[model samples]
Target: MLNIYKMYSEFLSSNIPYGGQYASVVKLLRSAKREILKLIKTFLEKDEKKPHIGKHFVPPLMDAVLADYARNFPDARESEVLSLFAAIINQYKVAMKDEVPRIFESVFLCTLEMITKNFEDYPEHRLKFFSLLRAIATYCFPALLQLTSEQLKLVMDSVIWAVRHTERNIAGTGIKLLLVFLNNFKKSDFCNQFHQTYFMQIEQEIIAVLTDTFHKPEFEWHVMVLQRLFSLVESGSLTEPLWDASTVPHQYPNNADYVCECTIKLLSSAFPNIMENKDLYGEEAAAKLLRERQRMLLVLGLIAPKMTDS
Candidate 1:
């Protein structure tokens, strides 16, 4: 509901702790959260411009809430940064709308602080945070073509660091950011510069870093890294049909079979595309149908892991 966005904007526009009254504070906070959830859904549905939501609203709101908490509970060690961010992100579509990249900037940069404090507290939400980061980039960058070379280099640095030192969750996040940066070529001038521009140069660097990390058996199970590359292949293959059109752009061609097989493997061997296409396999195709359910089951299994530590 547009009303949701308007409500947050109004709250954000208001003076928090207004008149420093207890009743007023509680009401504001309660209403603010309610509207925040609503806005998240409203934002993500639109294209990536995310106008009403940005550093202006999100950052200050977080600071106020976090500051208040810290003041009351001075010993607030390892709290729910990821969850809070995840809540916003989960509902980002409805709330973020036209302001995706700016939101990406706020999120990607802010997530680093979690590492500075308590990284383990957020391992559960780490992958999803990165996934949301990519969603922002995928929708925003090429659409507006705003990321410059400097921003791109910074992104590359972020990727390398996450790959080398952090946990698999962080590595996966980094990989997604890198993939989003690379995919940005679709809207870049480099697309016309050469048969394959220097933009493609990052592919090798990403592969090398991720492959080296994969060597560590502990991190090998991280399907996100593999999924990063898989995502690129999938994007290319899935768009082949669009490229086949006369009016649509078709400068390059990625092999569809390569993408299809990789996608299938990712489903069976590891992460299932639980939110995968509904029509990918019609009810008539049992093999394909079984595969879809297997993916769905796998998603539930991973997300809803065993309750007790066996």
Candidate 2:
């Protein structure tokens, strides 16, 4: 296994250009790298019983991944390097706590730099990037807390960007990643502070995408995230000055009222279009419109009502 990984790492170090005529070779190497990663993951998962695996193998494997990522290949297959880091973090968990910052810069920050400017580029990096975050947030959350304020903010911002992406897979993964982070730390002061700072912004983003006709496929995910957000506010888990902290008087009574008003406005804007165009158009089209309307009502009738009860 070590010999196989050494060969892979040496290839990454060599001046073999990625893509172009070398695309087939790169693809083949990527498959081999993935198999190596799976073996590494399996070994680490059993490392507790076999301490030699942890002591002898995992460190070198992590070094190889960081080195591969540092090569900064323009191709999407660079994402495989991230997958390797994710496997390590998933297996080692808090044992990788001190190494998290290094891993974050190598995988998260580097990948973010590549993909954030244009979601269309490096599509594979986008998926694997968030997947790496999921591994960190789920298995080694304490490591996330170890990051500096600016770094953590970037992490949050990237996830929000992911949620807003037009690509379904990236958006879906983004919402799931957000939910995982929220759920893991919901009981902590960190979660409360996070909501206090970004709750409204996050809520507004989710609402925008939720109402978007193009994002209908992600409706459930949007609702789930919103439900979690509202729960934090309602349960007093996420506290106030939520409206206007700088002024003498608050703008809204609570988070729910603000959300409800937004819902009303959205429904109002969309309602007239449907009413004016009473034509069925077609069975599929009409049903889709009806489903869209039903979704809006679900937000208004079900979710918003519960939110107001808060």
Candidate 3:
């Protein structure tokens, strides 16, 4: 195993061509990966006492091989690299649960940097990239929680950018990442962190986007975001000032009244269009529109009691 690691390390350092030398090196690395995965799987299957596998074996393998691939393989084929990385992450989930945070910290940073820097270079892979981020957020929240303010802000910005992406899959996956993050932290804590960083701007952006697209089919993603926001409010994680009339103006002066009015307007306008074109838009689109509308109404219901008639 050490010899295999040395060979992979040396190959990474060498200026090997992608055709022959690179192929051979990848073959050897794959073989080593299989062997390690087999041992890890055996340990997991038996549910046996194996501190060595977790503490000694898995961490070193992840550091020496997986980290190297993630950090050093910038020019490699994106799909191939992502597949290998995904496999490694899955194995880590099964075999090295304790070491996930440490390993994911290194890989997550590297992946974030790569996606942020080279997104345009591999436009076809944006969904896959965001999927990887969603996985990290889901599986490695402890590591993510430990990130410094600046690092977390960088991540937040990345997800915000993704939410605004034109691709639905990418944007939806980005929203999924935010949902995971929000689920893991208290709303107040996450809100405070967001307020200190990008909450004001993000809040405005989301409202603007929602207002502009509420009547359109593509508004589903924004609707999902709004649902999550409503969840925060209901959970008392998000406060009124963060998203009420003071933040998002409706015709009325009171925040709750304004929200109720906006919800009515959206429902009034969207329901007719949805009813008229129920067949034209197909079941999936119609279902999404109805779902979003219902969610908005539900949010309004939640906040209606607080509305003042002023």
Best of the candidates, TM-score: 2
| Residue 156, candidate 3: C-alpha displacement in angstroms | 0.9
**What lDDT score is found at residue 254 in candidate 1?**
61
Candidate number with the higher lDDT (1 or 2): 2
- Can you give the lDDT of residue 211 in candidate 3? 62
Summed over model 2, clashes come to: 0
Better of 2 and 3 by TM-score: 2
Q: What total of clashing residue pairs does each candidate reach?
A: 20, 0, 0
lDDT (tens digit, per residue) of candidate 1 on 150-225:
6555555555555554576566566556555655654466543311333223433444454463535424433444
Q: Which structure is stronger by lDDT: 2 or 3?
A: 2
lDDT by residue (113-229, candidate 3, tens digit) is 666664365564466666656666666555666667877777788878776665666666776676676666643346545543444455445655566643244476566666765
Better of 1 and 3 by lDDT: 3
Candidate 3 — which residues are off by over 4 angstroms? Answer: 17-56, 70-73, 76-101, 123-129, 187-191, 205-218, 234-236, 239-310
**TM-score winner, 1 or 2:** 2
**Candidate whose lDDT is highest:** 2
Per-candidate Cα RMSD to the true structure, in Å, reads 18.5, 9.9, 10.8
**What lDDT score goes with residue 11 in model 3?**
63
Q: Candidate 2 — which pairs collide?
A: none
Evaluated at residue 265, the lDDT of candidate 3 is 62
- Cα shift from native, residue 239, model 1 (Å): 21
